[model samples]
Target: MIDFYFSKDQGVKVTTVNWRIHKLAQEGVITRISRGEFTLGSGISYSPSLSNKQISLYRKLKTEFPFLSICIWDTSIINEFMLHQPGRFYNLVEVEKEGMESLFYFLKGKNMSVYLDPSPELIRRYLSDEKDPWIVKLLITESPTQEVNGINTVTLEKILVDIFCDELLFDAQQGSEMDRIFKEAFEKYAISESKMLRYASRRRKKQELEIYLNDISKYRQQPNFIANK
Candidate 1:
């Protein structure tokens, strides 16, 4: 939907092209579908609307660590794909490695239901039943993310990869439930397998997760999808 080179050849200034694109994006008439790629209409919506709690916490964190990368999401998003809902929910707060320790201690001191890089066993035993636990993990480099109202959250690609890789953290989403998750996600939104695989590679899940994704697509008879505008 965007043809910057063609526009430039037709005597459009680069700045003018960029400003028009920005205006369209602000109006939601077009959206950035990937890095350097914009689509003409509103694209798929992912994640539930941000709750007041989610927004407030993200703002507090941003004010304190303006330079750090962070993403936050509610566990309620998973419930849309889960058949057997767990008793408790969580707000996952993924941050850069350098900020993990400080944020963990800060949240801990405030007496929030917080855990830092919990083991699978630890999660299965204790935190699984606790209410609204805040799980902090190191954000993988190059994972795709988006910002809404200044709050950064994982992209659908990143979320699917995280569910695939972390068994302990997302235990309930395995097996048939995972199939449902993938199916529902694919049916509801646009997915970029290339983006997912690249992030999976960054997370050291390239080969295994690729096989898993391919297996999931076997019955659908679809072409390979990629991360492009």
Candidate 2:
């Protein structure tokens, strides 16, 4: 719209107009949704509350292995979008494959309840019995993540994709509950379809996830960004 108006009205050079657009976004006059999608308003980015336990875990792992790529978050973050809150919750610690085993054992040496990519059977038998256990998995490259108080953790895009991709881990959040979660997330946050689909592709569920998203389309309403535009 800026490009169209400026070219028709002022005949301004495209480069100068592009710079103005960048500055607008930097000054919070507009929000960038994806590569070329802009929305009006200050973006409502997701920033989960991190507990002292989560902070200590990241700090300890970083101190031990300074080069490891780690992302940590408590499952309770989902309660923000859920209508029926579950009583039990756990922590997810995703690390790069090379450091996964080493990190698991490091935490286990201190008697931390941890699991490394457990199966459905393992979930039903073991993880079900423990409260607040940490489930460590191999963090895929290019997965959407963010930093909270200097500790890495999953983004809203990754959380939505993971809920669809991992049935065993997110069983409590499945079925109609899952539908509600997706609807609430899209309504409340500035999610990038590009980032989500890229992560879904990494998990090999891009096509199936696309279908599910369409099924919930009727429940979603595009925000009225013109209020701030």
Largest lDDT belongs to which candidate?
2
Candidate 1 C-alpha lDDT tens digits along 39-156: 4455566755678988998999888889999999876787776677866677888999999999899888888989998887888898967877899989888888988877888777
Mind giving the per-residue lDDT tens digits that candidate 2 earns over 108-220?
Answer: 99898889888889999998989889888989998899998798988998999999998888998999999989888877776666678789999999999878877876643
lDDT of 1 at 69: 95
Model 2, residue 166: distance off in Å is 0.4
Quantify all predictions' global Cα lDDT against the true fold. 0.77, 0.83
**TM-score of each model, paired residue for residue:** 0.77, 0.84
Candidate 2: C-alpha lDDT: 0.83
Q: CA shift at 117, candidate 1, in angstroms?
A: 1.0
